[model samples]
Every structure is written in structure tokens, then in C-alpha cells.
Target: MKLACIENIRRQKQHVERYKRQLARHRSGEDISLKSQKTFRKPKQEKHLKSFQVYKDVLFDEFLDKSKKLQKLTNQILKVLSQVWESPK
Candidate 1:
């Protein structure tokens, strides 16, 4: 009987400690949520904007490269046409 009583007390103490820890966690979670409410969207939008700008820059660079290649191909074709015109068949 004495041993059972001692075990019950130990279990009660553990339960109380667990309850305190849970309450502490809940309080900290509230603080974090409050802080996030004020600052979350700004950082998220900034990150999205930054990524979008980078994507636009990449697309522009690709367009420039393709245009340059097309110009080179056009020049080569013009050169070939000029040669053919100058030479007798």
C-alpha cells in the first residue's frame, strides 16, 4: 500500500510538470504568432519579388542570346547569297 501511494505521488508530480511545460509552450507559441503577424507578409512578398525579378532577368538574357544567334545566322545567309550572285553558274 505504501509503495502504491509513493508511485501515485510520483505520477502526479510528473503530470504537473508536463502541464507546466505545455503551458509554457503555449505561451511561447502565442508570442511567436503575434510577432509573425506583424512581419511575415512583408518578408514573404520581398522574397517572391526578388525571385520574380531574377526570373525576368534570366528570360531577358536568354532573349538577347537568341537574337544574337539569329543575327549571326542571317548574316551568314546574306554572305552566301552575295557570293552566289557574284559567281557565274
Candidate 2:
């Protein structure tokens, strides 16, 4: 029983020493722990609807132009191949 009581006192003393050190650090303004810091998140602003629509339309027109050019080139190549195939070997 005495051994158990001594062990409890030792544990309590260690805890007290840890608490005192933390208190002293706090009083000196040196306790910079992540768990004690406050974090703030800035709010996000919405995009301008008209400007976004104009940008999207411009990008889409560019994409369509590129696709049309690619298709025309492919068709021309196919036509050339077909003529070569029809001609005598």
C-alpha cells in the first residue's frame, strides 16, 4: 500500500512540474503551440457571370475552328489516297 501511494505521489509531482513549466512559458508570451492558435479562413468571391460567359464563348469558338481545320485536312488526305488507289499500280 505504501509503495502504491509513493508511486501516485511521484506521478502527481511530475504532472505538477509540467503544468508549472507551461504556465511560466505562457506568462512570458512564449507558449506558441499549434493547438492553442486560432485559424481564420478568408471567404471566396464569386466569378463575374458576364465576363465568364464571354470567356467561355471565345474558348469554344477557338476549339471549333481548330476541329474544323483538322477535319478538312483529314478529308483532303482521304481524297488524295482514294485517287492514288483508283490509279493503275
lDDT, candidate 1, at 53 = 89
> Model 2 Cα displacement at 77 (Å)?
56
Candidate number achieving the greatest TM-score relative to the actual structure: 2
Question: Clashing pairs in model 1?
Answer: none
Instruction: Give one digit per residue, the lDDT tens place, for model 1 in 1-89.
Output: 99999999999999999668767878886444454358556667888999998887677778999999999999999999999999999
lDDT of 2 by residue, 48-75 (tens): 6656777876777789999999999999
The number of clashing residue pairs in each candidate reads 0, 0
- Name the best candidate (by lDDT): 1
